[model samples]
Target: MEILGDRKFVEVPGTATHELPPLLVRMSPRVRSLERVLGMANDLIEQEDMIPLPAMPVEHDSERRRMDLAVNLVDQYLAFVQHWQWGHSILEWIRQCETTFDTRLELRNLLRADLWPHAGRSSFVVLLEDKLIPTAGVEIEKAVGMRLTFRQPPPLKCFSDQFLFYLNSSVAHTAYQTWAHMIPSPVSSLPPERFQFQVVNMSLD
Candidate 1:
């Protein structure tokens, strides 16, 4: 057992380590550990500056495993940061990734609600104009003020599940319709007399 800012923990090698993301630490009771572990965690973060991407040579199986562990640890850490803190210090990390080809960005489960995910990619506002369109908030009561409740959820992958996706689909359809109307209609091959110039009446059978 060890003391970490008043709490004690069992120093098991693999157990407490796997859940940790190398980039950002998770804020929870699980983070209990000795001062040394915390120092090592801080060192892991500091080491990123000096060490390059693909941190070690991966010629042998052992070396490859080491490289994989390093990369995966950083990847897991970045994901944890995004999940826990949306408007986090993700911009600095993104810029670093863009600086080199070896650095890769693997992000999943992106949402429109978050304030500008690509803010890191381009520092200028011109490139970010696309995401400027505001979306309607699904608020139950505006009079009482905004409050998010997550106790009950709707059906999985249902039509109502992705409200923003449906909104984008609608916008796409409208744009397609507008473009379609702009195109000229095709001319008939046969003579004008062969086809009736007037509209024909048809049965609803």
Candidate 2:
């Protein structure tokens, strides 16, 4: 204090002290601006009936809702794939029956067509060709629910390769033998009891 006894300090004439916001609060406007732009874009996109995505306040409920939506979509796709595989399987079973019984048959003509997936227009001649069979790896994976998880492998091996094994197994063969005689002559509709596939479900690990 003794060294600069005459020195004096003064504030600038027009300067005034003001408190600035914290770092996060100061940056929020920019972030929120970007968010507004993104939200508008997503809203416009969703006008075409796209699924709504969860955003903001990341928490368990939002996360679970997102997961449920995803799972529902997966279930729907699986159902479609299963129907395809089943139709192919039924066509295959019919061919085997034709070979085993040494006779031709047709589906019963009903007033209203069934909604079940069918192989090739529900006609006798169209199903004879093996072109509609599920042979690709993707088809098999979808049908048998194959995955890279640590879960136990499905009972059957490659479904396409081992189709005959399951189709002619004791359970399936007995089911067929029991119901074959009940089908109407020339035209018949095989019910699920007569023929159906066992769908393998894959649970989340």
Candidate 3:
């Protein structure tokens, strides 16, 4: 199966000559520890009645720490997501696998009603801004006021589940860290499609 772009394969000491794209698997212990610190900062912030003004040197310390943690978490997640690769190392032998199935194989079409159970009772908007479009076009207006939902599909089964899993896990961790200070509830969910993966065949062809 050819997953990522075509690439040559090289054997490693303990592994076969698998033609897989470079996988970004390095974990940062500092980031993990920062997550814990962020949680503690959030707890402290929640206990405080108001954000301390900068002029108040004593109060500013905690506030500064809180902001620093949030910013660091976002930065760390961005760095990891940007450089995602899919194999062991430069010399590791791994086969590339491609998606034999159609890309839209498992899309589940959803209606607005499915998403919004209490439409009239509460008001919220789901804005989907496409990156390709230069401006926020008619799609935004059309989706506004009206509850809208769309198909959400998981990656194909043939793809590297490990890659997807790690990507999603990192996103979840980042999202948790980002929302920890602001929201009372735990940040359990990360938006979909934060990371993507492809499969490639081992053959040179």
Candidate 4:
């Protein structure tokens, strides 16, 4: 029998340590121990200047599995820290891996939402001369809110998803029909013209 903090634990004969780890003695004490170790580790890591590199979005499932493996490895290290309380290497490595997952998630979300559109890259605005005339001969409204010139950044709205879709869809129906016929027909009773043109009509719509 041994006492850890205020509680007493009975050690079983011939029982492997893995069967009932020391941290499992009490649920509440185990959680508090982990939190305390994490707090101290944070302070030490910051003081030692051992912060991990900024995490990037994972490009493949394999990368994701590697990241998860790092997390499980960190959890194993925490058992070391819970007892020794002086495993700086253990704590630092754990903090680095765990922090990357959080940071990468936030960065990925920001890239998907705020940075998704080309026009959202910057907030800067430019104005044209009040007397400027458009070469396209379109009538300009006298309203103050009307923007009569291109003032946005390089990519502009032309690079946006909607604009790209519009540009691709601008081809004439006759051109699409001709292009579709150039391909060999499948083994079906439908005429070659109907088989391909139907696909073209659906795509245009």
Candidate 5:
């Protein structure tokens, strides 16, 4: 209150007042899903297409609707992924890590994820690379009904040393494995599964 005295304190309803509870959005670390968002961020930069969001008028109703949908998708992307175990197709799950001691901390690294308040545990973490934040933040702010920007410790800074992996016959199995290594699968109907890793025992200390 004492630092910078500029004008009298009168709250403006448009930007200052809170009228309703904020809507929460949640998302999981699904790389296939967020690729569009990354592309949208690129679009905010040098647009190869002459017609961008603003120039499109209401007459182009279909395009305008698509644009609105994209903004909402980004909002959902901003939300944290709520987890539920025991659901069908629930291959993996870790619980209550933000507040409790994580048994799987040895396997999953919280700081490795890219989202803010990176204090929780997840079986998998997905993050946009640090360099993309500035340009993407600008695009998010441009959303007609949304306002968003990046902050300190940008997303994916948490997921410092990680990489996407895949399974191929070329990746042979060894007696021992480390890092983001692929392991053999026993199922007769399924091929080998690739796994992300966090190695904590390399130090001789």
Candidate 6:
């Protein structure tokens, strides 16, 4: 079996055409269930047309009621589709945020507050990609009764500086040393430069 992109191709003896893998066929039950629901919803909307309204001013009220019912059905269908799309996207965003927060916490623990006293004094802005709109800052004097002077750091620059500083320090070196000790001697003897290089590559990927 050869895998290409999302599909697998298998060459069989005396076979003229490639067939879909068994896993794809196994998913038919779930797919059919969704299709049945969608088909039923469509049929219900269509069924409204079977009820006839009088073509005269005497039945104006009845015609209006039928139109309203049809409109409501269309709205329900649209709402279901929109919710399905938005729900998936929102869930993915939440998962990504959770992962990001966990990694940030780890970094924060490694570079303790004592190491950077200026961190609290400095306003750190969180940037989303290259955009600068949604930046966060502390209202320093808001909590305390006194007027406090606060210095803000250039967002990306501050993060880069602190990260690089820790990477070069003895704490990072010693942490890696301890980690290496727990592993086999052959693995422990691997050069620090190589480990750093591998870390950088993984981060970039």
Q: Write down the worst ten-residue block by lDDT for model 6.
A: 194-203
Residue-level lDDT of model 5, residues 1-205, one tens digit each, is: 0111431111111222222111122123333345665455334322434234566466568566556644543443343111110110111222222222234333233323342222221112111111122221222112210111112212321211111012111111111122112322110110002221221211122
TM-scores, one per candidate: 0.17, 0.27, 0.20, 0.16, 0.19, 0.25
In candidate 1, what are the lDDT values of residues 15-123, reduced to their tens digit? 2211111122122212223343334434453454323446665567654554554454433332322222211222223333334312322222111113222122222
The CA lDDT of each predicted structure is: 0.26, 0.30, 0.28, 0.26, 0.25, 0.27
Instruction: Supply the global lDDT for candidate 5.
Output: 0.25
Task: Estimate, for each residue in 123-166, the C-alpha lDDT of model 4 and write its tens digit.
Answer: 00101112232212211121111111112111211232222224
Better of 3 and 5 by TM-score: 3
Better of 1 and 5 by TM-score: 5
Candidate 2's TM-score reads 0.27
How far out, in Å, is residue 156 in model 1?
A: 33
Off by over 4 Å in 6: 1-61, 107-205
The candidate maximizing lDDT is 2
TM-score of 6: 0.25
Error of 3 at 119 (Å): 56
Better of 1 and 3 by lDDT: 3
User: Least accurate stretch of 10 residues (summed lDDT) in model 1?
Assistant: 139-148
The most accurate candidate by TM-score is 2
Instruction: Specify the poorest-scoring 10-residue window by lDDT in model 4.
Output: 119-128
Give the range where candidate 2 is weakest over 10 consecutive residues by summed lDDT. 20-29
- Write one digit per residue (lDDT tens) for candidate 6, span 1-205: 3344643222222323322111101101112244444444445434534345556645768656655644544433333233222223223332443344346532232112333221111111011111222112211112111111112111221222223223323332353345324422221111111111000111111
Instruction: Give the Å shift of residue 153 in candidate 5.
Output: 12
In terms of lDDT, model 1 sits at 0.26
